[model samples]
Target: MLLAPKLLRSSPSPSALIAMGALVMIELTSACNVVRIGERKISRKLQRKGLDANTALLGEANVHYWDSGDSPETAGAVPVVLVHGFGASAMWQWHEQVGPLAAERRVIVPDLLWFGESWSRKRDFSIDHQVETLVALLDHLGLQRAHFVGISYGGIVVHELAAMHPDRVAKLAIMDSPGRVYTEADHAALLARFEVEDFADVLVPTEPEDIETLMALGYHKPPRAPRWVHRQVLEGMYGEFRDEKAALLARLLEQLDELDERPGKVTQETLLIWGEHDPVFPVEIGERLAAELPEGTRLRVVEGASHAPNLEHGALVAKWLVEFL
Candidate 1:
């Protein structure tokens, strides 16, 4: 089930009108509908790369993904699954990566439940539920094992997936996610850094300013776009499932607190990728996590990149993934 563009019928709020005024004052009329246009272009690019937008009814959710077609070029190639983070969908987040990675291996990128087309009637928002949905996706696709790459929130999901079902994961790559190493202090600091009582206000953005703050934190060099662009992004991407996503975050925090009572280290070889100046989960967290994992676990720090190195330096991240996996 490919996601259709949302039809926003409501009138623009006071802040939105002010943003429009700024856009008009700047005379950037040609940049209207930037988000929608960008989505269409990304869809075209994925199609050109031999990836078809697809969906599978896996358990309770409909998992929407981009799959490199089963052609002769990639018939026997090992599958690689890319899971996106909280804010954006799979296509927007993994656009730069799919082309390069799919050239050598069959790449599958799925939108997590409640983020894109994937959703469920069940109220369970635990990490275990997310892992189960992903495992069901693999089973539905007839894939016994595949290399998994996850970013931020997606990284936590993949980590749990790898730990819970070792035989089903060939290798693991976690980017900017501290996994079970995330501490109570880290959570409190995150709330302080954002100056918000609830972390959901930072991750599940409600306004253009929220988006700007998220981008400033996530990117080393955040894109300089008009306020209207941020408004469009807030509406197009982060507007839906607000409460459900907040619940997911709450569950994640609870899981982090209870990590010690759960399973220990995973057996599979893991690759830990972190940004040099990640304020969300700093390099120290990555280093600590690397030590706690299996003996051969490797950590790679992308210099000058903040929370999202994969977005900041896509080619370099893709190269590392190819070498490590």
Candidate 2:
């Protein structure tokens, strides 16, 4: 049974604003104990595909992850770390890359704090915290350095890590991310385009319509699924980590004003993969992002794809990742 979370922010409508004041009260009483059957099955199937489920205590958070075991062959193979975005766990986000990449390399995929089984009550939800936590996780695994692959929000974290800890990153791959601090105008325009009051409403969807809106914006050719599937996913995959994600985004936005719009100088080798028809970030942003990075940063545009290109064209994305990393 898929039970949906009742806590949802409103669209940019008068009716939505009317109930905004009561959001806190409603969230206090709202419980997110839903277990999505479909996601559960996928998780198990991924485990069988050699992505072993594991957990590690990093600071106050207990991070759940999928690990392709480190072995004699893997010792020489490059370690590739996959970080997920806002909506789902690492398993759902990088399902395609894990199995294929693991065949030749060591892959580590982790659920960021406040997503999946990772949770913490600490109010410090900056992107740097995630970077530090991930660094610590890498340290715990005895990994000195690895190539980093991130998408959307995860890409932002990878960017920060590459900028702050250049020595620790061998290669960086960022997909469909803003890549630089977004200007206030950029933020306002995206909100207007999405027809939503805030990002939390869209990223952590509560209703099937919200999921539909996310899909419509995320893909140039959105996958067709039954209404029940969206509902189950909304209830199961998106129910947990409501307030925490909002706080995390809020903190991330707070840093935006502090950073100049121009991309900071990053020393590591970089690969930027984007969707040609990305409605969320747009292809123009990718062009500008490429110019902002260090010399020789390569940009690859996936034709006929959108924000979530990895999902829309998994085979193409996997090929790019394999070649880049």
* RMSD to truth, every model: 7.0, 10.1
lDDT of 1 at 307: 92
Question: For residues 52-100, what per-residue lDDT tens digits would candidate 2 score against the true structure?
Answer: 8889988776878888877676669779999988776777778877767
Q: Write the per-residue lDDT of candidate 1 for residues 164-264, one digit (tens) a residue.
A: 89988998999999888888888888888878888887888888988888898889888888888899888878878888999999888888888756865
Span of ten consecutive residues with least summed lDDT in model 1: 1-10
Off by over 4 Å in 2: 1-37, 261-264
Per-model clash counts, in order, read 0, 0
Model 1, position 277: C-alpha lDDT score:
86
What TM-score, to 2 decimals, does candidate 1 have? Answer: 0.89
Candidate 1 segments whose C-alpha is farther than 4 A from its true place: 1-31
- List the candidates' TM-scores in order: 0.89, 0.85
